[model samples]
Target chain A: MAVFVDLNISHTVDKKRLQNIIETAAHLGYSTVAINHVVDLQQKKQEIGKPKCVSELFDQFPIVQGKSRPIKVLNRLTLVVSEASHFRPTNEFKSYDVVAVFPKTEKLFHAACMSFDVDIICIAVTEKQPFYFKRPPVNGAIDRGVFFEISYVPAIKDSTMRRYTISNSLSLMETCKGKNVIVSSGAEKPLELRGPYDIANLGLLFGLSEGDAKAAVSTNCRAVLLHGETRKTALGIIHTMKKIEPTAERREEEEAPVLKRARTEAV
Target chain B: MVRFKSRYLLCELCVSDQSSLQLLDDRAVFTGVRGAVCRAHGDYGAALCSVSFAVKYLNADTGVVFLRCRKSHYRILWSALPFITHLENRGQKVPCAFNCLYVGGTIRTCQKFLIRYNIQQLHRMLPHCHNEAERLEVRRAVLNCSLKSLEKEEEEDE
Candidate 1:
């Protein structure tokens, strides 16, 4: 039940806006916040270049020719997020409470290179595009170190809740899962996203077995969201998430398990 | 991949004619785009690709025939198979499923893919035809052969 604040859509990525949102999210005691990229995937990568310092140069222009996983731009954002986590902020943000996302799937794959080991979040589409990079930012990514996942819906609009669609996507999900992949919302904005139980319910309505639905939402999504980045980068993650803090004790009632109502495969 | 729960007929008149004549087994694989979407290529929104397709019959003058495809892939398939143009003509004796693609059991996008960029697996399938009548017959034959063989295999396994 993580609440992702959409940084991808906001007009500003400047310090003021970022800090303000972080403080709000932290004070709200949300366990995690996805730094969503609002624009089209490619543009977001170009905004951030290759990582600086030491042995590796991710900005291999020749290597990252295509817009999707251009070497340098992809690597740069990994460093940026890693560095940004250490950015000096207001007392609340400095508490190291939020994890950032480049919001670009291509950059995410590259960021997961040797420099960083994070999952690339993708959106599910009828069409397929190359989301994995050849030379990842890290070494073990291809063989189960780095993870990836896509946000999916039963149908976007006017589409029927067909089993083939689910089966096909599920097949793809299964295939990717074999490669250390995770499933995600790839949600454009918050309103478009459903919580864990909501996603699980969607699975049930779409012909998935109860086990599959539970795995898709509860296990699959939680595993992706509660990643190492979510764990290591944030200073007060467990402290804020745990009932240990006096300020967060008020969330006890809200922590009730989500309602088990079934969600239709399509809206 | 995309799929539709509803079954679509390639040709209503041809379907009734064929089955009654014992030319068809009432067994068929109708191909068409389901839950289709059309959009511009990128943020620039420069051009548009209308993603639509369905199964169809081709070279109407000669005989009965059908084919499956996606509208977005029409250009590629048309270029690959010369007879595709003849099928595109409205007055031709055969029509085609230009609006969709059928692969295996479910209707799907004709576009192919692998697990990732670096992998070497193909994810989609498409039909090839030269004329309307030829195309329809080919589509029918493909479905019939595949279904009959599958049934035989199932019977054998049982």
Candidate 2:
């Protein structure tokens, strides 16, 4: 079964609150979650560093509500790029499980959609989308398996932000027609996080059909995770270490069968 | 008599402070529900809710409310219920939420389900009684409520 995943949890300095948010997410049946470390490239004197290891957050990971397995926590880095040169491919990005880009301008958005080596392109929900979502970039992003993420935490906090969230998402939905869109909660606090079902229902307001809304929390997030995986390897071709012991055992068995056949032929 | 089809939502007001429920009337809930629907679902949903929305029954003591709306648009209102964080009453924001217990086609069905739900909640709470006195008090209250309900049924039968 495709498990539910919340791909964006705002990374906080407060350990207690972050634990609370993850615990709440587990209680609400999220099988996987990502702690997003955001770096705004527009700001000067900002340094990009390796994200904190997610395993160190808890001694024992909390179990998902209905699933028998513990919730999978992943580290993600969101680079907010205003200018074209803000994002540069480096070994530092490879340390994170997933990489996301927030484009501040239409040109950057087009670039991010077409050629950016990222898993998710975040749609700004705090303010109105400065540029309309054109057909070419959105379709290209969908074709390239890059998902658009719309965070719903701002909408839950303030009514004015809620309006912006709805309108911005509606416009994106108009161009993409709800494909490759993932609705995640950029929740710093536990209360801001809602259940997956509640968000799927909320997706109706964002102009997604019933089925696509459900997929936004499950299948689309999984696809983004897979897209992120390709970044670590050369064109999604992973060469894993093979166990030599199993091959030796199989060789011995094959030799024994061949010896028996030769003896039978000689007899 | 013209038969108007409607759907009734049986919702329970979940709050930390029980007294805050007293300030919640039909109008407060109406405004709260409408505002939430408007915020979550936009003007289209708000318009759908306003057409035939009414608070048919509200038990302030128990925090149970029965909301009636057109059958086709109850889903829009239902989907928006979870977005309501609090209800503003008398210049104070009451920290609460609405948990929809049941959705029925008529008020009678909702009333029947509410009685059944209350008895089930009573039975569930019986074991959590802190002391012997509280246990005995809960037992007495349960017996008295059952007896009162039985009497009402008998009166209706007669």
Task: Judging by lDDT against the true structure, name the best candidate.
Answer: 2
lDDT of each: 0.32, 0.83
Q: Between which residue pairs do clashes occur in model 2?
A: none
**A161-215 per-residue lDDT for model 1 (tens digits):** 2333345455544444334433334333222333333344444433455566555
Q: After superposition, how far is residue B120 of candidate 1 from its true place, in Å?
A: 53
TM-score of 2: 0.72
Give stretches of model 1 more than 4 Å off.
Answer: A1-35, A38-116, A121-126, A130-145, A158-168, A177-181, A188-191, A204-212, A225-267, B1-158
Return model 1's CA RMSD, one decimal: 21.8
Q: In angstroms, how far off is A215's CA in candidate 2?
A: 1.2
Question: B23-106, model 1: which lDDT tens digit per residue?
Answer: 221122121112121210122211221233344333233222233344434323321221111121123222221211122222
Worst 10 residues of 2 chain B by lDDT: B149-158
lDDT of 2 by residue, B45-150 (tens): 7998887898776789988888889998887987787678788876778766666667899777887888787766665456557899999987787567555775
Q: Point out where model 2 deviates above 4 Å.
A: A234-267, B1-31, B38-47, B50-69, B89-91, B96-158
Cα lDDT for residue B4, model 1?
36
